[model samples]
Target: MTASTTRRTAATKSRIVAVGAIAVAGTMLLTGCGDQTNDGEAKETKAAAAPLADKLPQAIRDKGVIKVGSDIAYAPMEFMDANNQPAGVDIDLGKELGKVLGVEFKFENATFDQLVLGMNSGRHDIVMSSMTDTKERQQGASKDATGGADFVNYFKAGSAILTQKGNPKGIKNLDDLCGLTVAAQRGTANEDLLKTQQKKCGAKKIKEFISDQDSDSITQLQTKRADAVITDFPVALYNELEGGGGKLFEVVGDQIDAAPYGIAVSKKNPELRDAIKAAVQKIIDGGTYGEVLKKWKAESGAIETATVNAGK
Candidate 1:
């Protein structure tokens, strides 16, 4: 079967929030980690510091904290919980990374579009948001170039289509998006993909919103201003489960352009990059990695190893 076909099956079996009993079952499958307190499930026993901690930049070692820039609105990856504290798979990973590096992980919540700029400007040490590792981003070819941030891939994800719970428009895939209004976060690969597919879909209307927030796009769909929202697969799935209790929206298509999500560090900080990569692998081997993903109901996206600059 083709990748799309495989994705379709996966969506049907594991991710999509269908209507009626099927929707309840799909939501139940992932509810394992949803109700825990923000810090509850992510609180894993700390592992010994990895040797790479010694390789960290002196300034960082002295500071004893790795400042992370993230748009904390993507649920289950990085977002605020009931107590208004940052919590999610990425947040838990960052905490584990801190343990391995022998330092605290300090998150600096910023607009998604500002993350790269923040790193380049020295406002943040690393970005652990569920940022995709793409060729264009890794190359820093965009107008917002900050000397090309390097990435240490840690998870797998892809673009998926989300529509009203019942899929009123009969949307199935990109082919079905023709002439329809689609919403996606601005500056994200999802938006870029839609722009590229516009012509192929007979000039579909694409609406872009600030990357820091996904609610805007969801609002567009809910208000009938957009026929669908295209975003990271996990984000859409999580929203369907928690945002409206599986009643507001449903994933309609197979994931497309599957890619790795990476922890971004400035290219100037190769030492930090290598240190983080090693720390990540250490956690994966120590079992803490799986704990974090499982806590977020995102074990499906877990990676066995971490690779730097693996974008393609």
Candidate 2:
């Protein structure tokens, strides 16, 4: 959903094409992504020389590439830049981590809701979407709702409400949406928050206009289909600043549900999880993490240390 679901068709195709190129290079250069056959000696030698090569599982070590599933729509996290290339905090951090692991962190576009499920199904080696590390996800509460995986928490953020500029509805908080329509990305924490708010709305229950991506929700708000949109604080701020060249939207009220954003890794791949944890800590220590957040103006969500499933 990079650039939003409306942009999903073109952007996703661009990423797939970009990824296909990378995949092909991984094959041509690394001889089938480190096939391990005698013909792959050139790739093995180069890959084995990486700084953190010893930390990865032998199978992945040979591949020299980590398949990443990401929505790629949330700006400042993962998004396609004007150049139509993948760029953002998550993308930058993944690049640094890739250097340490001696593997190309090849991101593939997917709907935010499908990232974890796809990862669990073996479509990806990991998921680098801005996914929260909730307890239910750790225990695999639902096959599609939250993938069963270990989370390597890197950043923390809270959800916020985004309303159209000029305060048209005089909305200040969640309660204001009691009888209004709201938009949120399907399968996100924001969607859940809205549902919880609905119960309190009583007779004037909140009407929902859920979309596949946040941008679409923003579009709904722009078109007056929704009174407001709920999303991550950083995302709300980003849209408020960039949307309409900083004139289209504005953030209202305080944020809620502050929690760590984790990179999803299979529980079965403890080695990969631990390796990523270490790699992130190294990136933080090395100052690359700070640089990335600074570039995205997202230092507010920066975490002091990388941990596992630190979200409550």
Candidate 3:
């Protein structure tokens, strides 16, 4: 071969070798991009997973106190007992519930409306109030502000009217108190029921009290500002017995509509909800539930069944 041909041949071979090296480098670059892309995605996943506890089951055992929210206005269910300390069927149950769960019990008192807001804001954990579980309230109670769990029905309830010994006007039910003033706690089922009756039957005699505490209604009755006081059966019975066991006032008419009193939890806190439900079941199974009702003089209409099942 000629020298020029040899030189050209050598140059061509070197070019081929250089091109092959470029190809290998390009392949490695592509492979490296793929791996780096996957790595970036994995980092993002880790970042997103940082709040896993927010979605995972809540650690109920860690929360030393089962922070409960209550109005403390509804007597016999939850209120200031004879010793000026919190006592009632619900209070007793809550105490037992905490004891069973190996947690301390803490209560924060607020008005009915404030209780709902407090639960939503995480100011309190569960509400031990004798609150009726309704569709609208259930919707509100299932919200994040309410802690992400639905209500667990623990007791059955219905409304009733409390009046002076004679029931002078013979006010038998909501129908009879059309024009006469009726007292009820603000932002409660009693007031809601009254509003519903007024809207449906054109009755507008409702006097809203600041709280469901017995003193509020007793004061209203003593002053004759209200003709009758509408509240729950347990509360009505409690008030009547407080002054002297039906001697000062009388329970008038039958209960108006059936309702279930439920303990509310956050929608995200199913673990805590289940814990509470389990504690409640323990109380019911141990016969402590009935004893509490009897001690509070609320055994007649207290709940005998539980409907709180976890993961449902």
- Highest TM-score model number: 2
Highest-scoring model, lDDT: 2
For model 1, what is the error of residue 57's alpha carbon versus the real structure, in angstroms, after optimal superposition? 1.5
Per-residue accuracy of model 2 over 108-176 as CA lDDT, tens digit each: 999988788899889999999888888877787844435588899999999999998976899888899
RMSD of 3: 16.2
lDDT of 1 by residue, 210-277 (tens): 33377688888888888888889988887777657788889887888889998999988899999899
List TM-scores for all candidates, in order.
0.80, 0.84, 0.73
**Model 1 C-alpha lDDT versus the unseen true structure:** 0.80
Candidate 3 local lDDT, residue 2: 28
TM-score order, best first, reads 2, 1, 3
For each predicted model, how many residue pairs clash, with residues at least 3 apart or on different chains? Answer: 0, 2, 8
The window of 10 residues in a row where model 2 has the poorest summed lDDT is: 1-10
